[model samples]
Target: MCRFLEELGVAHHSAGAWHWTSDTYPADAISLRAVTSDNFVVVDITNEEKVIAEVAFPAALLELHEKAIYLHEARQYQVEKMDYPQRKAFVRQVECDYFTDAIDYTQVKILEEFETCPLGAARAAHGEVRVNRQIVGFKKVKFYTNENVGAGALSLPEQEMHTTSFWLHFPDPFLARFSDLTPTEKLNSISGMGNALRTVAALLLMCDPRDFGVSLTEEIRPGLEGFEPNLHLYDSYPGGIGLSAPLYELRPRLLAGALDLIRGCPCEEGCPSCVGPAGETGARAKDGATRILAALVEAGLESGAAPQK
Candidate 1:
C-alpha cells in the first residue's frame, strides 16, 4: 500500500512511516454497503395471483426456492416455481403438516489461523476463511413431528464470502472410537454438531441467528493428522464482526451447553430443537452429536482445564 501510494504521488515515507499528502478525503468516494437492492417478488397464484411479499436477494435462495414451504400470516403455501431470471416465486395455497428448509454445500479454506489450542478430544481454532456455498436442495420436515417427508433439488448460483470462523477437528489418533461409523455417518455427525453449536453460540453472543453460518470441513481424509470431518461456526458478514474470537475463548461452555441442550431435548431421534431434523440429518444425528460433545467435555475435564472465559 505504501509503495502504491508513493508511485501515485499521494503519499511519502519519512521517519519510517508512510504519510498521506492528499488534501482530499479518500472515504468520500467509498460506499460502506455494496449490497444489491434486488429482491424476489412472491406471487400468490392460488386465486387472483396477487403479490404477497418481497424477499431480499440474499435470503431468496433459502426461503423462496422451488418447493419451499412458505408461511405467511400463519398460513402455508407451497412454492410451485421459482423464476430466477425474473426474480419471482410462484406459490399456491396448501394445507400441509410440514415446513421446508434449504440444504447447501459449503467449503471453507483457512487463509490464516488467528489462534489454535487443544479443546478436549479435538483442537479448536479461529481464523480468516473463504467460504463458497450454493443452495443445492430443500427438505420438507413435518411441523410437529419434525420428520423429513420430502425433498427436491435446485440449481442456484454459488455465493462466496471472506470472513472469520471458529472450527474444531479431531486428531487421527482420537478418532479410533468412531471406526464403527461410515465416512458419510461421520460427516453427518459433524453436521449435526454444527447445528447444535451454532444455536448455542448465537444465544451466548446475543446475536441474530442469521448473523452466523454453519458448515463442515470440505473433506474427510483418513491418515491425515487432523483432517477428519469438522464443524465451523462462521460470521455471515464479509469481514467478521469480532464473533469468532469470543467463541474460541468460550469454547468449553459452548460445547457443554450444546451437549446439554441436545441431551435434554425430548425428541426421540432428532428435532429442530436439538441437533437437527432426523430425516434430513439421518436417524442417528442426535446420538452422534451427543456422543461427540460428551467426549469433548469429558476430555476437557480430564485435562484439568476450565473454560478460558
Candidate 2:
C-alpha cells in the first residue's frame, strides 16, 4: 500500500513508513467515525463566561441546543443560548425533575442489495444505503413516572451518510396479517422489534451500541407509495466497516436471538431492556413484535430450516 501510494504521487517513503507528499496531512482530510472534528463548547455565563464542557458535532445539535438540559456530574444545567456560528452553548446551573429525549427522523434509501433470502412473505437482505437523519424535536419526561411533561422544537441541520445495512422487508402479504393494527401501532411494533434487534446484534457482534444504528421505515424507495416496511441495522461509519454483510448472513440467528431476548424479559408490556420504553413503544408493542417474530420462526420451521442458536 505504501509503494502504491508513493508511485501514485500521493505519498513518499520515509523512515520505513509512507508520509503524505501533499501540504495537507492525510488524517486531516478524513474522519475516523461519523462524527466530525467540530465541537460545541459549553460555557457557564451566569456570573462570568467560563468553559464548562465540550460536545462533539454529532451530539451538539441534540445536547447543546437552546433550552436543552445538559447534565454534568449529576448536576443539571439548562441551556440559555446556542451560538451555532461560534460553536458554543451558554448554560446555567438548574434543577429539573426530568431529562430530555431527542426525537430524530431518519430515512434510508437502498443503493445496492448484495444478498437476500426469502423468509415466508418477507425478505431479509443486506445492502448499501444512504441515510438521512435530522433531530427535529425533544420530549421531557418526569423522573420515576416517565410521564412526558413537555416538548420543544429544534431547527438543526440534517446529517447524511452512505453506509451498509442489514434489513428485513415485510411484503404486503405479511403485513396483511396485521391489518387490524393502526398505522401508528404498526410503526410502534416495528420500532420495538428494531430496538430488540439492535441490542441482540450488538451482543452478537461484540461491538458497542454506537457502532451501529437501527431504523424502521416504509420509505426505502422514493416515489414508491405503499412500499413494505423495512427494519434496518446499519453501520454507523461513513462507508461502513464490514458489519452489515455478516449480519445479513446471520439473519436467522439474529432473529432467534432477538426473539429470545424479548421473551426472556419479565416486563408486562415493554421496557428498554426488552422491546423499548413502554411510553414511546406503546403497550402492545412487545406482543406485536413477538407475533411477527413467531410468524418468521414458523415460516423457517415449515421450510425445514429453523433459526439456530
Candidate 3:
C-alpha cells in the first residue's frame, strides 16, 4: 500500500530517523529546518508529534502523511507556537494491510442451512389467500480498537486483535427499512447500508486528523462491534435480501427504498432513519447516511449505470 501510495505521488519519510530521548524533544524539535524534496510531500506515519514540533518543513509541502489513518482524521493536533497558543495542522494519511486468506465460505453455507424458511399460505377463503413470510438475510458486524494508556500491559508481545461479537437481532423497525432493497443495495448493505454503516465506514476508513491512524474502539456489541470476514448464520435476518438462502420478491424493493432514503440523507454523523437517533448509535444517522448514499450514487453512475444485479 505504501508503494501504491508513492506511485500516486504521496509524500512520505522513513521511520528510521525517528528516535526520541525525552519530553524536551517534541518542543525542541520544532525549530529544525527541513529540506525541500522533489514533490514537497512529507509523510509521517508515527505518533511523533513531539518530534514534529521541532522539525520545520516548508508550508509548500503537501504533507502526504501516513499513520494508522483511522485515529486522527477527526481531531486536530495542538502544536504550541513559541509565543502563541497553538497551531492547527491538517494532514491526510492512508493505511493499508495485507490479506492473509479468504474467509471460509462454509460459514455462509451454514447460515443458509439454518435459515428459517418461510411457510407458504396456510389456508384460503372463498377467493382469498394468506401468506406471511419471515425474512432472512445478513446484517453488519462491528469492530473496535483500544489505545488506552494501561491496556497494552495485558498483551503478550504487545498485540491487539479483533475482539467480541454481537449476533443479537435488531428490532423489526430497523429491518422494516430494508424490506424492499435492490440487489446492488443489498450487497452494498454489508458495508454501505444505513447511517450506522456510513458512520462505521468513516470510522474505519477515515484517518485520524493528528497522524492518520485506524484502530478499533473498545466498545462492544454484536452487530456493532466485530469484524466480518463473511456473512454467517448469526449475521442474517429472517426475511430480506438473501440470494443463496432464500429469495423474497418484495424484500429487495423494500430495503432499497429505505436504504436510499437513509443513504441519501445529508448530515455529518447521521440523521433520523439513517444513523438512528444519537442515543442509538452515538450520533444522528442522517449525516452518515448521506455520505453512504452519495457513494452508492457515484458508484452506480460509474458502473455503466447498471441496475443492481
Candidate 4:
C-alpha cells in the first residue's frame, strides 16, 4: 500500500506508513491508520466504496475516484438506484449501516466480515458523487469507539474539542454580515448554540456542570446576564455539536436514530443535517460544521441533538 501511495505521488512520512499488518489490514486498517494520523490526503486504491465512505476523504483527492464533482455527487445519490422511494430509503439505511459498521469494526476490531463491503456500494448508490478540489474537511474529523452512550461516551465529542480548548472568534467579514443584528443579537445566536450544546452534553454525559461550564461569551457583559452559562463557555476552535462513542458504546438502534434525523434535515448545504448554518458562517466555519455533522451522521448520530435554533 505504501508503494502504491508513493507511485500515486502520495507523500511517504511518519504519517504515510499504512498498518496493513493488522488482521483487518486492507480495508478499515488502512483507512483508519491514515485518518488517525491526520493525513490530509489519502491516495486510496481500493475498489471499495465502503472504505471511501469510512474515511470521508478530503475533497481535494476525489478526482482519483473518477470525474464527479462534489455538488453533483450530492444530487446523484437521490436517483442513483431507480429513484424508487423504497430503494432510496434502503440506500440510506445501507449507507448508514456501512459507515457505522466500518467505524465500529475499525475502533473495536470486533465484527469483521460485515464491515468489509466494497465502496462500490457507495459508488453505485451515488453515481457521480465526486469529491474533488473542494477542500473537504477531512482533517477536522475525530472519533471515539465505545459501547455506551454515557457509561463511557460523550453525546457529541467534536474534533475541534480534541484539537483546541478555545472560544469562537467571528472573522471581520462574517461579523460584518450580521451588522444588522446588533452585537448582542450576534452574540446571543453564537453563544446560544454553544450554551445549549454544553448544557445538553452535561445532562447527557452526567458530568458536572462546572467541568463543561455553561457560559458562551468571551466575558460577562451587560444585558446578557440571563445567559449565565455564557460566562463559563470556553471558546473552542473548529467547534460545533457532534457525538463521540467508543467502539463498544454504539448500539444499532442508537446509530439508526442518528441517521434518520440526518436524512430528514432540509438543508442541502450544512444546516442541521450536514452541519450548521453554511451561508451564515465564515468560510472556515462553514466547512467544519458540515463536516462534523456528516461525520457524526456517518458515525451513527443522525439524531445527535443540536441546540434549539
* Top candidate, metric TM-score: 2
Candidate 2 stretches with Cα past 4 Å from truth are 2-35, 220-227, 301-309
The candidate maximizing lDDT is 2
User: Against the hidden reference, what TM-scores do the models get?
Assistant: 0.73, 0.85, 0.22, 0.20
Q: After superposition, how far is residue 73 of candidate 4 from its true place, in Å?
A: 63
Better of 1 and 4 by TM-score: 1
Looking at model 4, report the run of 10 residues with the lowest lDDT sum: 123-132
Worst 10 residues of 1 by lDDT: 28-37
- Tens-place lDDT digits, model 1, residues 11-84: 99999998989888877655444344678999999999899998877788899898898888888999999999
Which lDDT tens digits does candidate 4 get at residues 198-307? 44444454544334322232323456432222112221112211222211123223223433443455755335332244443333332333332234335333333221
Per-candidate alpha-carbon RMSD to the true structure:
6.9, 4.0, 23.2, 22.6
Lowest summed lDDT across 10 adjacent residues in model 3 is found at 121-130
- Overall lDDT per candidate, in order of appearance: 0.83, 0.84, 0.28, 0.28
Model 3 per-residue lDDT tens digits across residues 217-292: 1222357533222211111112221222221222233234545656465655444445444443444234433443
